[model samples]
Target: MIVLPYLQTPRARIRLAEASDAPMLLRYREENHAHLSPWEPLREPEYYTLAHCLKTITEGREYALQDRGYPLMAFDPDEQTILATFTFANVVRGVFQGCHLGYGVAERMQGHGLMREILEPGIAWAFGELGLHRVMANYLPRNERSAKLLAKLGFEREGYARRYLRIAGVWEDHVLTARICPDG
Candidate 1:
């Protein structure tokens, strides 16, 4: 299990998801349904309910404990309001030392540099605590913000993959990017 430490940015707090966070998470998803739906997979009708949220949280914890993945939530430091979520999945340890990242910030919080603040520490922790050598992030070519954010974090644009992901019910092309930890 990868025990996560609380990470703080200028305006956000990034930490692991717990069972108690289900309601907040569900609320965020509900509010951002239209905003996120375009970039995410289709969710079950029940997936946004409290019960589903709890199940997700519990599964996230289990994955983290087993070092299978890391699911993190970002919140406003002052208000303690849920602001976004991110996950480090496809974790391959041992000699491989890599993981794939997935993240999204609320629409209202889009231009606040919150993503960078959240990603920097999270990336650092993956490299430091997880001893990962490289991290991969992918985004639709049209997602300029995500592209810029990844570039700002030292990720190099490696190439493009067609039909790399199923987004909004369609297979979409993505720009593959990677960041190597200098300390690794």
Candidate 2:
């Protein structure tokens, strides 16, 4: 197994998703389905099931072992509930040495700076341990909060893509941004 270090902030704790997290992951996705729909692709009913979550976690572990992805979960310390998820996916080595960052903060946890706290160390791990040279994050133009957060994290606006992705069953434009590894 790929062991990721635990990260703690005043309000949250971040760690890699494990097989035991399947049930909670399912609940988290089900609870946040409506809140996240506009920002994600349309999901089939089975996407929110425990079986799907289990499979996802299993695949995530295998991907991590192969150094292709890292799936992290941020939890509310007091409530012991998942407050956010961050995925560093599509990792490429050799000359590329980069990955795509995808994240979601729970509806109730928005505006709390929890995602930022979770990302700080997660990005550090990508740069420091994973040895990635760049991390890219793309967001819808309409997501002002996401834009602000990316900017705050030192991700420069790289470009805009027209019809870059299918979100909520419709083609959507995206603002691409990236952060280079400081030590690379």
Predicted model with the maximum lDDT: 2
Q: lDDT by residue for model 1 over 1-184, one digit each (tens)?
A: 4567588988888888777788888899899999999889888899889999999899988888888899899988863578989999989978888999999999899898888888989999999888899999999999998889999999999999999989888999999999998985
Cα lDDT, all candidates: 0.88, 0.90
> What are the clashing pairs of model 2?
none
Quote each prediction's TM-score.
Answer: 0.96, 0.95
- TM-score, structure 1 vs. true: 0.96
Clash count list over all predictions: 1, 0
Encode model 2's per-residue lDDT on 6-26: one tens digit a residue: 778888878777777888898
Whole-model lDDT, candidate 2? 0.90
